[model samples]
Target: MKNYIFCLLAIVLFSCSPKEQVQTFMTYNLRYNNPNDGENRWEVRKENVADLILNYQPDVFGTQEGLNDQITWLDSVLTNYSYIGVGRDDGKQKGEYCAIFYKTAKYNVIKQSTFWLSKTPEEISVGWDAALERICTYFLLENKETKQRFYVFNAHFDHVGNIARLNSSKLIFSKITEHNPENYPCVLMGDLNLLPETDPILYLSMQMDDSKGLAGESVSGAEGTFNGFKHDKTVTDRIDYIFISKGDAKVKEYKVIDDQVEERYPSDHLPVLVEMEL
Candidate 1:
């Protein structure tokens, strides 16, 4: 009787204890336009996106071009973490939304806010003459130890609006580097829409180091991240990226996930994940 009670107590304690937290991050641009897409819609590829993130096991995730349904769906599926940051697409309540997901067990949230990527920046509305409006999600995350904390900014710039893209890039740079808040580490991830050698990309490098793939590797994973669907197969370009601030933290590894899952492709653009350590 004594041994039986002891064994039961041990099991209870083990079950109640906290699980280990992982240290990693992932970013993806899940394309919008589900309602109009008809047959090839977001619903067809949503589950695969969630599964891809789960496989990499990033402590945080930044996503671009997520609609209301997709965001809600992600929130529903991802119970272990919390997500915030609204999309400033068409109006206050329409168009694509960008967001960040943080692991609850891994980090404590200190502060979180959203900023617009438009001339009329106060409101979450689309920029005039821009292909699409952009909003950046910023999070101040702290470890359980209380001493470790850092900032993460995620955004999606205009696809066709060149002026908007340059303007948005300037805004991002100012937010991250202007104040220089005393050794605060930061990780910036998103679908910038610009390629490796573009003007905006170069400007970003001034503030942080762009995380690239291995030396010998020409590209990270599959060719282009923007797959029209699993069937459309001409992958090209390296637009999506994950970069760490040059001063504070070190970017250990960067990869573009191009796994051939059976259900469908993960997102319109392949997810770019970076593992960093401070």
Candidate 2:
């Protein structure tokens, strides 16, 4: 009778304890919706984009330059996932969205919101010297099984503004600190439009660890994330990145998925994937 009681107690404790959790994250820029993109139009390449995500099945993924219809279409095809974000133009269904999607079975969104990367974060305003409207979308999610919660931010900086990029990075850091003071294992992923050595990237690196940099010499896959639909190695640049908050998670693997089908690419910017254990 004593032995049986002890066994039952142990089982109960084990069932209630937190389990080790591993998650995959991907950031891809879908290149927006363009009717005159010739062979690279959204209609022509949408299937490949969906197929790529289906194959990898990232636990949480973010996309930049995705229009309302484009995101809606993806939401339709990615049946097991749900997303949160608003258009950058008017805080509604207009312009591009930096949308973040997550698996419904694994995680539940507790809170989600979007803010423009401007001085007035509350309103639909463009920041200092930015060429176009930019926004960042984030979600506070709780793991269903372990009950562990974390934050994920997805963003896109202005492509043509030098000062805007720097300020945007600072704004992002401030927002993270403001919203997630507990610093809940945050993950930041996006097409930042800046290189690894640039000031904006450097500023962000101070706050988080670049998954690829953590990989160190063990890094594998393509060196560059932008393909520009040309798929030429010489004409490419490394602008997309995935960064995880310091001491929040352990990086297992980092990859720039360059897979193609019959000479056709999924998107102009390659998807960067990071596997992490929390």
Best by TM-score: 2
lDDT score, candidate 1: 0.74
lDDT of 2 by residue, 1-278 (tens): 99999999999997876643778899999999999898999999999999999999999999999999999999999999999999999888999999999999999999999999989988999899999999999999999988899999999999998999999999999999999977688999999999889999999999888988876665667888888889545335899999988988777889898898778678899999988887
Estimate the lDDT of model 2.
0.91
Identify the runs in model 1 with alpha carbons over 4 angstroms from their true place. Answer: 1-22, 89-93, 178-180, 213-220, 230-234
Write down the TM-score of every candidate: 0.82, 0.92
Error of 2 at 80 (Å): 0.6
Each candidate: RMSD to true structure? Answer: 7.9, 3.1
Give the Cα-based TM-score of candidate 2 against the true structure. Answer: 0.92
